[model samples]
Target: MKATQELHNLGQSLWLDNITRGLLTDGTLARYINELVVTGLTSNPTIFDQAIRTTAFYDDDIRKKTAAGKSTEDIFFELAIDDLTKAAELFRPDYDATGGVDGVVSLEVSPLLADDADGTIHAAEKLHAQANCPNLLIKIPGTAAGVPAIEETIFAGVPVNVTLLFSCEQYLAAAEAYLRGIERRINAGLDPHINSVASLFVSRWDHAIGDKVPAELRNRLGIAVAQRTYKAYCELYDSPRWSKLAAAGARPQRLLWASTGTKDPNAPDTLYVQALAAADTINTIPEKTLLAFADHGKVSSTLPADGGDAEKVLAAFRAAGIDDQALAAQLQLEGAESFNKSWHALMQCIVEKGQSKSTGTQAEQL
Candidate 1:
């Protein structure tokens, strides 16, 4: 069996961290679902930005919406929603089979609103309502501002994918926000089974610290952080606090590994994917990473439920003068800034394309 399937058999979900209109129209997304064991997908400002700029797949929709005088943001969401809705439909079977735990697709709100809690909450609600798919998750960052929005959005009963988390601390905070929302729902006599996942990013840690750490420690920080976070996740779910909520029908917020693609060329392409294969967790991979794993990846031991050796590995990093907590905060800030840049670039691309279309000149040259 392919290592992807092996990982799936070990009870981890392998999700694709990409989506494009061409992937959908050309049946590539569906093929991934069938052949690659990809049970879910995720999209953000950056992915959509690239998809829109490089393909004529959305040109007709852009032309129609431009003619209708819709703003660039409006056109962007319209195009995004259409694509995600279709992708959501393709995953509906896995969603139903897993009882809403495994099959899901995530769409993030404007990263530009990362600092605006109210605006993020509003966008999440709008996106979820428009999506109209039970398996669709409205992704919100786990920033200080986004935490409250996440809690309130969950209380309002929208499934959320908490994104851009960089540390166990950030993951725990996001998980707590999800729990608080569920707890409030139970207090208010509402269903406690609203689904959510806290996505802790993996590869970026190694990328950020690769040069800082010794050569022997290269490409190891991300997996160690993930192992530590997984340990926390298991402990949280087993605690009395969570047992009470579970008794009330609340689902434990699953931990998702984002940015799992390897950034270091010297490391195996499937380094993160192979190392972080823990049951009940999710690994969201880029398409190339997914294929690489399926081709030559090896799955050996599952991550220890008790977070074995994670602390020891972390201590080594600490001895090297690396403070994981402080770095997590910095990475989260940088991620938000990167997303904001991508969001702005996407909007500008659409505006320029709209202008060119209006002027009878194609956006292809510019």
Candidate 2:
């Protein structure tokens, strides 16, 4: 059996952290679904930027959209929705089979709005309505402002993927926001089962602190953080408050592991994958990580519900003068900035392409 199937059977969803027009056109995404147990996918500015810049697949559409006077951002979202809508249909079966628990494809709102709660909320609604897919999730960052946007988006019945969370506290905050939104819906006599996921990023933690921590702690902070977060997740689900809500038709907001790809070549390729395995959670892996896992990954033990040794590991990092909370904040800020850079570059690439096409046509007339 493929390691991905084993992980899926273990109850941890395997989502490919990538999507492109080429993947869809070539049937690669479908094959991953049929063969590799990839039930879902995720995309961001960086992914789309790479796809649009490198592929000729979107050039004609870009030309048409540019000629129509659409802004670069407008063109980008049109292309994004076209691809994500298709991917959503491909995963529709898993979505139906699980009653919307798995098989969710995520599209993030503009990273430039990461700090603008109102902007984020507005864009989320527009994108969700535009996507018009039951299994689609609008990804919002877990920044302080984004927390309110997440709650409001959920309250408005838009499924959300809370992204860029780096600590257990951050994950908990996002979960709380989700619950608040669901509870509000129940109060308003609306459906309470608003699907959502709090995506806690892994691997980056280890990359950030690899040289700062002890050898025993290297490549360990990420899993330790996830282990701790998973315990909180289980506890929250079993809580009387959540149970009451669940009885009233509310669903638990799932915990998701993002940035699971190994950053250090020296670390085990499957380090994050093997350590963060748990039922009802998800691990979004890069294509390389997915292939590597299929080749050599082995799951020794599932994450303990009790958060086994998480605090001990965290304490070791603290002793090394690494404040996980402060670092998590830093990472979230940097991640948002990185996406903004990618978004700007993407727009520039589109404009340049559009101009080149226009100039070529004019020359042909000569």
Candidate 3:
């Protein structure tokens, strides 16, 4: 059996961390669904930027939307929504089978809203409504500003993929925000079964620390962080408060492992995928990593519910002079900034492409 299938059977969802028009138009996404156990997908500004800049698949639509005089941001979202909704349909079977637990595709609100809570909330609602797909999730960063937006968006009944979370502390904050939103729904006599996922980014931790720690410590910080966060996740799942909410028909806002792609060339390609295998959690992986894992990965023991030496590992890093809290803060800030940069570049690419199309048309007329 494919290791991907084994991982899926182990109960960790395998979501492709990519979506391109070519993938959809050529049935590649569907093939992954039918053959590779990829039940869901996630996208961001970087992915879209790469897709638009590198492929001609979106050229005609870009020209059409540009000709319509839509703003760059508007054109981008329209294209993103169109692609995501189609991918959502392709996964609809898994979505229905799992009762909305898996098989969802995520579309993020403007990364520029990373600091603007009100704007994030509004855009999240508008984007979710615009997509009009039940399985589509609006991603909001788990930054300090984004936490309140997450609460507000969730309470408004928009399913959210809370992104950019780093430490266990950050994960808890996002989880609490999700909890507050569900609690408000119950208070308002609304259905408490609103779905959400708190996405904790991995891999970037190791990349950031880079040779600062010893070789034994290299490529290990991210999984250690995830283990610590997973322990917290287990605790939250067993919490009496969450049980009460569950009884009220609220779904547990699942813990998702994002950025699972290995960043260190010396590290095993399947390092993140194989090590982070825990049931009931989601691991969104890059396409290359997914293919690598499916070909040669092996799933061993799953993450221990009690965290499996996570604290010990963290302490070792602390001894190595790594400040956990400070690094987490830095990573969160950098991640937001990275996305903001990608968003701007994506918009600029759209503007240039749109203008080039117009220029070519006028030249032909001449």
**What local lDDT does model 3 show for residue 204?**
96
Q: Model 3, 85-190: lDDT tens per residue?
A: 9999999999999999998999999999999999999999999889999999999999989999999999999999999999999999999999999999999999
Task: Identify the runs in model 2 with alpha carbons over 4 angstroms from their true place.
Answer: 358-366
Whole-model lDDT values for every prediction = 0.91, 0.90, 0.93
Ranking by lDDT: 3, 1, 2
lDDT of 1 at 306: 87
Where is model 1 more than 4 Å wrong at Cα? 358-366
Of candidate 2, the 10-residue stretch with the lowest lDDT total is 357-366
TM-score winner, 2 or 3: 3
Task: Tell me which residue pairs clash in candidate 1.
Answer: none
For candidate 2, write residues 1-366 as lDDT tens digits. Answer: 878889999999999999888899889999999988999999999999998888777777888899899998989999999999999999999999999998889999999999899999999999999989899999999999999999999999999999999888888889889988998999999999888988998888888876887787788888888889989999999999998899999888998999999999998889899988888999999998998998889877899999999999889889989998899999999899999999999999999877666444422433
Score candidate 1 by TM-score against the native: 0.97
Superposition-based RMSD of candidate 2 using all C-alpha atoms, in angstroms = 2.9
Scored by lDDT, the top model is 3
* Comparison by lDDT, 2 against 3, better one: 3
Which run of 10 residues does model 1 get worst, by summed lDDT? Answer: 357-366
Worst 10 residues of 3 by lDDT: 357-366
**Number of clashing residue pairs, candidate 2:** 0
